[model samples]
Target: MPKPTVKVWMEEGVHSAIFAQQAVVGVFKLPQVTCLCCAIGLPPVHPNVHSTQKGRLLMSSITSTQVVSLSSQAPRPLPFWRRWLRKIEWRLLLLPVIGLLLWQGWVLLAESGYYADFIVPHPDTVWARLQERWADGSLVTHIATTLREALSGLFIASLIATALGYIIARVKIFDYLLTPYLIFLQAIPIIAISPLIIIWFGSGLASKVVIAAMITWFPMMIATIVGIRNVSTNLREMMRANAATHWQIFRHLEIPSAMPELLGGLKIAVTLSVVGAAVGEFVSAREGLGYLVMYGRGISDTPTVVLAVLMLTVVSLVLYSLVAMLETSLLSWRKAGKP
Candidate 1:
């Protein structure tokens, strides 16, 4: 069999035309033919070339070439607005939009004297109060105080929980010993013990930090325990077969397996830490958003109270979002596994 020859005559306005013919003819093996006009740089014979055998072959080859060219070109990009819409997490906006609409309806009802301002203040009044606090710098100071306490408590809690969780998960005796105490601690309401904690540590930063840490600790401990224990048995056996040390097995096998769960626990702890800090402040504090809330309520300043609550909500959301973003960056493998 004779191999088809692909000859190119480099000329203006004809490179694509000849390349297409050569490619299709070689691929489909339709016939051993040449385009004399294309190879020698003459004008196209005819747009419709079905009049003769050679004309039909030339036309088909050119048609196939055009098809290949169209398929190979990069697709046109979407318009900016369409691209932006696709990028948005639209489902996540639903709850907030609904809440906003409900709030507006309540404000409308309040304007009709359905509820007193001191009871359920208008959204505009709350916004004005937020703006006033922001202008005086008190809002920023209160938010900083709360965030400092919350983050400090979370850091300490995470360290302790991780250590305790690992020890309990690895040793059956430790697990048996600690299980009852953990349950007891979780069952007892933090509100019930706040006074005692305030008494022991005083109505200062120490007590608040301890309170926040206590509130954030249990869930993280449980998550870590579950994650470590749930690591694949096959992986552990393989590590053992390789004579891996306890530290090696834990570092290489357990920690990676447990990362997804650990991050999940961290996200929960981040939100709870905000609540813990607020609770601690509520029990005893002269400053912080919780204190602001208490002061506003004592004076019947409903707008101020509303503003403080909104600030706490914002803080919680920001912290949770940070944890979620960190989880995405670190546990990208989990996302990769998804369809």
Candidate 2:
């Protein structure tokens, strides 16, 4: 038997290095032994070690050098304004700025007498009409009335849609029985049936609420059904294994899973609710933004019509924003736990 020996090699100007040695021993059942040799020198080896096979050394060596480059460290932080502008919301402002430039171009063209006041009223004229309505309190009154109707309708529609959607999702019989009528209602334009709604509910707040609800119902219903159905089957099975009741399973396993889709549908429904309220007002109403538009058209007041439209746009945007805020608040856990 002869003592095993290791030879060392090095390159000049290498800052740091590591050397390791591994030995494998025995015939059928070999045990591995590793030794760490520092860069300064190799470790001392045992004097009485032997190999079982001739011309075979049960040894391996690995050498590694640590390289440190100054440029590869941390990067410099961006300037305050540069970092701020990199945000998505800040970048989105470019869209509205572009829109404003296009609108100014249109205003300039109108000022050049390229179009009649009735065709493209001056921005100042529209502003003046809006100011007049605001001063007379009519703008506030009309906006309040329309918002009330829209919100009321959305609340009622959400309740009905969510309940029916859950039932349809859970019960095959209800799905088969009610799906045809739901499709029929959705396919028919609300405007075509709005007159009948007005006739039944009369030209009151009840009719307006009903119209708004009808308009917003289908999207929410579909969203609820999809959301409920998409819940994990494993979770439902686990709940059943625990002997959970149907109500318990629905509350614990289904609703939370369905929230994202439900919120998405609610966003769409909230915006449509505004349109619904306006349509109801168009069919039969005396005091709303829609009525203002109708009355302005009858009197040939283009500025008033523009103002009413701007108010409607504002209302829709506000409602959509509220829904978005609610979604963010309720789904904060999802965002926090995102991969």
Candidate 3:
């Protein structure tokens, strides 16, 4: 009797190379070779593999020992959950962590420095000052005053910017005529003329609104221009074929298409509007969180300063979240349409 043509082997032990032996001999005999491991319930090679009729025949004839031995050497795969966790977005997750660290570090540094004399009352003493202000109803009034200004500025700026952006996006001539001037306006630092804004509008609500609008307008314009122009030419052509009026096309097609970009711009505008409003308040107002911060700084009341900073931060987060929620509600249709 001839020696057996097939042998079997596994990585963990000194077994014969039976699967390879069987594959080679089967192909030599019948001009075909199929995967022995696959025959014994091992995972198949990827779908992109090329095969001929002869290869199929050889694969079909492989011995059980050869098939079983090859199957035992299958590679280990990572557990699904472990792999997913490894890919979790660290950069996004780390942002809040970094902010917390900075907050703590600022408190520590403030407690130790000679400059602390002017920067604030000691971090330890600041909380007591905040408590006193809160007890007297002063903190709440200041917080409410600043919040109203910031939110109003954000809302009005968002509306005006969206409207103006839509017009510029729709009209090439308007875009050309106004875009450069808008860019020039944005290039100037808001802080440099915040005093001038107070001088012009006289430390009142109107000046804050103007500053917020200026800060909010540029992103809205750029986003709208990009969004409207990004509308599908196919959709435009379909509307034209239906003999839709320009206004009808805009109402039915353009605005919906541009909503995601518009909402993104609005989110940025929301945060910046708060900054603009606060800066305006810092320059002149006796009320608002900016005024609170200014007041706390002047007297070296660190705790009160922290409280004002915290209030501003919370307000910005809340406003930004509201815009994001709006985006989610409005864009649900687009998401549902996708595969």
Candidate No. with top TM-score: 1
Clash count (model 2, backbone only): 0
lDDT of candidate model 2 versus the reference? 0.77
lDDT of model number 3: 0.72
- Model 2 lDDT tens row, 19-60: 233333322212212111211223322222222223222332
**What local lDDT does model 2 show for residue 316?**
98
TM-score of each: 0.74, 0.72, 0.64
| Model 3: CA > 4 A from native | 1-124, 334-339
lDDT of 1: 0.78
Residue-wise C-alpha lDDT for candidate 3, range 82-155, written one tens digit per residue:
87998797788889999889768767777766554446445556567778888999988887877677777777
- Show pairs that collide, candidate 2: none
Query: Positional deviation of 84 in candidate 1, in angstroms?
Result: 5.6
